[model samples]
Target: MANVLIIGAGGVGQVVAHKCAQVPEVFEKITLASRTKSKCDKIAEMLPRKIDTAQVDADHVGEMVALIEKVKPDMVINVALPYQDLHIMDACLETGVHYLDTANYEPPEEAKFEYKWQWAYHEKFEKAGLMALLGSGFDPGVTSVFTAYAKKHHFDRIKTLDILDCNAGDHGLPFATNFNPEINIREITANGRYWENGEWVTTKPMEEKRVFDFPEGIGEKDIYLLYHEELESLSKHLPEIERARFWMTFSPNYLKHLEVLQNVGMTSIEPIEFQGQEIAPIQFLKALLPDPASLGPLTKGKTCIGNIIRGSKDGQEKIYYVYNICDHQECYKEVQSQAISYTTGVPAMIGAKMMLEGKWMKPGVWNMEQMDPDPFMADLNQYGLPWQETWLDKPFR
Candidate 1:
């Protein structure tokens, strides 16, 4: 049993709180904190058991440190924004507590996100006898674990990897992002990148396009190539991987709205003077968009996110595929959130459990692939995001 302090009250944070509360044996006490305590309190009302809520600005190391001292939690689960990752990590280091986050850190002034920033803390964490886990979300979380699992059981050497993330749910809105609008828009508008022959290849936003037939009745959807942070860690950790790419599905309507928003400068991250004040257009746009939490009950259909890996086994070339299919309505029924939050949040809970249970505790910063995939994989099946595997005859084009 352990006490946990969760420092985000968005859709993902709600799912993490609910999932954590379900396993009282592992998460004995949970304190959900966010910038707005009301949001945390709202999520707390939905949980099976009562959890304490607090208001803390995770952007400030002082506020985070104070909260940790007050809560005295064994670990802090960060479902907060990517920009706050380091601040929370700093607090953990100061308080001598374990730390975990679903995404790597990215600078608030820049659109780029990578693992280099967080990876630098390994030496400090090791010296402090504290462990920090990064990128425990779905793609970075489950997808990275899937790669490690394949390398362990299915493949002796991994040659190529294509991570396909398809969210086919319809929220019935003209234009809305499944996650944070600013973060989502920044990632989509940024240049696309992939690794090949020990180098990175960059392309225009939404430049690379491919069609894939997803399993479990999701059918065919268009997937676009984008540089997700997982590719960086996977390539470094698995040196044998020659090529690794990440792809996501997007509808034409969504693309059209994004195009219009770009044309009007609504998606720009640069601050513009407005009424004697400066605000980024993207931030203003995020304010106009629907809160992602409200989309849970409105979303329908299913999501299929997994990896199509090509590698070798027993001196013979083979193709392997592993993925999980989650339904939006079903997730809402259980956790009051869509599959997007549920998928990301469930892995986060399991990751925290892995650390609390001492199955993955270590005195250093680590990625999902660096840990043993067996116990985490088993917990996935026992948890909400159950996965499936199949051997493919043809490679993903």
Candidate 2:
């Protein structure tokens, strides 16, 4: 059993709290905190079991450190924004607590989402004998584990990896992001990139597109290449992979609204003079959009995210695809959240379990694939997100 202090009360955070509460034997105590205390209290009220609530600005290291010192949790689960990752990690280190997060750290001024900033703390965490598990969400989390599971059980040598994320759900809104609008828009508008041979190949945003026949009836949707943080970690950990790419599907209506926003400068991150104050256009636009948490009840359909790995098993080339399909309504009925948050939150909770249970505990900064995947794969079936795998004779692309 462990006392977990979870920061951030967004959709993903709410799901994490609910899932963790479900497994009382593992999570003995839960404390949910965010900048908005009411949001934390709201989530705590929804759960049958009691969960402590607090208000702390995750961007401030002093406040986070104070909270850690007060609660002194065994670990901290960071579901806050990517910008606050380093601060939370610092707090964890100072208080002698382990750390885990769904996303990697990105500097506030730029939109880059690489793992270098977090990976730099490997030695410090190792010296302190504290473990930090990075990127425990859907694409970076489950997809990484799926690759490792494939490598251990299905392949002798892996050559290629394609992480496909498809969200076929509709929230009955004209245009709204499934997650944070700022992060979602910033990622899509940035240049598309993929790793091949040895180096990165960059292209115009959404420049390359392919139609993928998704399994479990999600069906043919257009997937576009994007540089996800997992590509860097996978390329480093799985050196045999010659080509690695990340793709996400978007609707035509989303593209149309995105184009209009870009044309009108609503998506730009650069600050502009506005009535004697400087503000980023994208931040302003985020306020005008609907909160992603509100879409839980309205969202309908399913999301299919997985990995397609190709390599040799017995001196002959082979292909395997492992993925999970989540229904939005099903998730809401269970956790009062949509599938996107459920998918990400379930893995976050499971990863925490792996660390707390010592199945994946090691004194260093590590990605999901670096650890043994058997226990995680089993937990996925037990805790909501059951996955399936299939052998492929033909190539996906």
TM-score of 2: 0.99
lDDT of 2 by residue, 62-118 (tens): 999999988889999999999999999998998899999999999988989899999
* lDDT comparing candidate 1 with the true structure: 0.96
TM-score for all models, in order of appearance: 0.99, 0.99
- For each of the candidates, give the backbone clash count: 0, 0
Question: Which whole-number lDDT from 0 to 100 does residue 116 have in model 2?
Answer: 93
**RMSD, candidate 1, Å:** 0.5
Clashes of 1: 0
How displaced is residue 77 in candidate 2, in Å? Answer: 0.1
